[model samples]
Target: MTVTVVVGNPKPASRTSTAATLVAKGLRPEAEPTVIDLVDFGAGLLGWGDPAVAAAARTVAESELVVFASPTFKATYTGLLKLFLEQFDGGTGLAGVLAVPVMLGAGPAHALAPDLLLKPVLVELGATTALPGLYLSDRTFADDGVIEGYSDRWRPVVRALTDAAKVADHA
Candidate 1:
């Protein structure tokens, strides 16, 4: 499967990015996901038709599965992510893709941010979200079993959906 991990953490190589990569790896051990650290894109995300930003968005849209990760900021996803997502067309841009929204927070208060905030945007962009969004605590994200447990329960379903979507697309 073609898998991608898109991180919206303001800092390069932040815990949010690491957790998202771990989740993708856990979901498919043999697959090395295309990791897009939006911080690297920087100012490119601010305008329309920026080649680099457009290419990255295209890669995410073309992937069968994508893990969209962000550190909770002001109780929601970062504006940086918002800038990137704005490039896609609502309700169609992410068609045939399955998205997993991941959020890392300092505390449990914003644990639902993944599902409540990010997933809706992915859905609006036409990405199928078949599993519950994952919320990881930043403190223990590296050693915690959250990624594995989530993959164990949801990976099979996601794979099935991804395959089915591909078949449907070709038909």
Candidate 2:
């Protein structure tokens, strides 16, 4: 399976990026994961006519599974992330791809934003969304689901995504 991960965090070395990388690190070898830092696309994304944007969309089109990661900002993901996603035109944006959403926030209050926002967009693009969006707080993001005394208790999410990714039946 060709797995592609889109890092939507605008900040350099953001916690959300780190967490998404960690998940990619654990991908099964057969998947051949590819990580694309959306920042690399730059200002060209503002206009759909850029060739670079089309290239990025092509990469997304070829992947069997995709992981969309972004830090929860102002209750949703960053505008840059949305801009990058918008460049995906027609069937190339999604079709035949399964999307896993990973989001990080300073607090648990914005935990549901991943599903509320990312999933719908992915669906609109023609991708099948994986169940149980993963949400991690900045603190204890590597620990037992507890960030500095707060427990998000979101383990099933990771398990479900990993299990779903195994559905790579590319022929």
Candidate 3:
């Protein structure tokens, strides 16, 4: 399966990116995900039609599963992520892709940010979010079993959905 991890952290190679990569690996250990760290795009996200940004959007759109992750900024996702998301063709850009929203926060105060805030945007962009969004503590995401636990519970479901989506796409 084509799995991708899109990190919206303002800092390139931040902890958020590492957590996101771990989440992707937990979901599909065999798949090597294409990691898109939005900070690398820099000014390219300000306007439309940049080749690299467009290519990144296309890569996400074509993936079977994508983990859209960001650090909780001001109790919501970072604007960098929003800028990248804006490249899509609203409602159809992400059609047929399965998305998993992930957010990292310093504490549990904004634990619901992933589902309450990010998931809706992914849905609006036409990605299917069958599983609940994942919220990880930026402080302890690596040592914590949260990603592994989530993967253990939802991996089979993800596999089923991706298989079905592939069939539907072919049909």
Best by TM-score: 3
lDDT of each residue in 1-171, candidate 2, tens digit only = 577888888776667666676655444335556777778777887886788778877888777667789988889988878998887655546876767777888888998988888888888888877555677876668774333222123334434554565555432
- 1-171 per-residue lDDT for model 1 (tens digits): 899999999999898888999999888777899999999998899899899999999999899889999999999999999999999999999998889999999899998899999999999999999889999999998777778899898878877897798798899
The lDDT, on a scale of 0 to 1, for candidate 1 is 0.91
Give per-residue CA lDDT, model 3, range 2-99, as digits (tens): 99999999998899999999988888888999999999999999998899999999999999999999999999999999999999878998998999
Stretches of candidate 1 exceeding 4 Å from the true structure = none
**Model 3 TM-score (2 dp):** 0.98
Q: What is the lDDT of residue 86 in candidate 1?
A: 98
User: 44 in model 2: Cα distance from truth in Å?
Assistant: 1.1
- Better structure of 1 and 3 per TM-score: 3
Worst 10 residues of 3 by lDDT: 21-30
lDDT of each: 0.91, 0.71, 0.94
Residue pairs that clash (backbone atoms under 3 angstroms), model 3: none
Per-model TM against the reference: 0.97, 0.78, 0.98
lDDT, residue 120, model 2: 84
- Candidate 3 ranges beyond 4 A from true positions: none
